[model samples]
Target: MLRLVLAVLFSGALSLPASADVSIKRLFGKEQRALNAIPQTHLVSLLERSKAAKVSSGGITYSRDWLAGQPKQSGGREWRCLAEALYFEARGESVKGQFAVAEVILNRVSSASYPDTICGVVHQGTGRKYACQFTYTCDGHAEVIAEPRAFERVGKIAKLTMKSAKRPLTKGATHYHTKAVSPYWADKFPRTATIGFHHFYKQPSRLSRN
Candidate 1:
């Protein structure tokens, strides 16, 4: 089942149509609208980076060494937003934790309750005081990526996570907070996974009984 799913996604990723302008916008825009209009060049850049990491039969090994070996990665606006979020929020976390945080952002993109794009989800409530999805966005401090190596590590993770098939690492979690403090919403959302220093949660379903 997993291989079949991976095959389908891989096929889709490689199925660029013959055209003068081959681009992710042409290939996946209809399906992955949450990515918004990713520039053609950014998609090509990601594909180039993917070539450096040969697929292993044993599957992904989450470690700094593994991430370091992957080619340095960058992408358009959406990818930058996700990469920055991981750098700020989960740089200190284990590889799995970093992926888990990325999962939350992606989950929010999938959910109707939040914005449809990665940048939109990451900066959902910016501008007003105390109204942002990610603290780094609204925390008043500049989003300075001072640590180039850490940024590169998270950038690679962001690249892979964006391409990864929807996995159960966070079990569909859309929210999370470090274990140090409990937010008011923590008690309300169902806790899904506890990984590293974060506790992940899935927002309650909003189905209405008529």
Candidate 2:
């Protein structure tokens, strides 16, 4: 009697599900084919793009979309100084790189070794030829802003970076230079993150006369 009941139940399950089985298999097949059509590299690229689009609580999003959502920003001398520094030094860098440069400047502001303000940090060694902290200031050529759009973007970055609560990007970096040349001071300071064309550094706490 138990054998007969088990046989009936098995036969019933087999006989009633043809349409259901086909539907389930077809749906799974379509999804599998869709996934298989995407190349592995392409999938990885998509994941990276998605992560870039995410707005972080740290207030530094590396996506143009995040910048577009921000209101137009403006400020006085300090803001202008930071904006100009970024434009001349890192306008062509990636968004993350520009922020990294800004982080270095801001970090200098908070450190005892450098000036407490953005403008002061930027123009620390101006007025003498080849002696300025920033080359653009002492380069002798006119600081003509040929690219207004690029300047505007850096200006926005400057504004946001100033208002950011923390400087986590460069880890309190106080100095940075492009990878093109190994500056005399590069070996002295501890190397930090290297972003875009620049390598960032943090000076020793006591500071050096170089």
Would you list the C-alpha lDDT of every candidate in the order shown? 0.79, 0.80
The residue-level lDDT of candidate 1 at 157 comes to: 87
Once fitted onto the true fold, the runs of candidate 2 whose alpha carbons sit more than 4 angstroms away are 1-58
- The per-prediction tally of clashing pairs is 0, 0
- What's the lDDT for candidate 1? 0.79
TM-score of 1: 0.70
**Per-residue alpha-carbon lDDT of model 1 for 1-210, expressed as tens digits?**
223444586577665555623464454445465344667656544443443333343255566556777889989999999999999999988777898899999998888888899999988888878788788988889989899988989999898888877655889999899999999888888899998899999998873110
Q: Give residue 8's lDDT in candidate 1 (0 to 100).
A: 83
Error of 1 at 158 (Å): 0.4
| Each prediction's TM-score versus the true structure | 0.70, 0.73
Cα lDDT tens digits for candidate 2, 1-210 = 223444565566576667777765575566667777878867654543465633355556676557667777889999999999999989988777888899988987887777899999999889976778888898888988999988888889999889888776688888899899999889999998887689998888777534
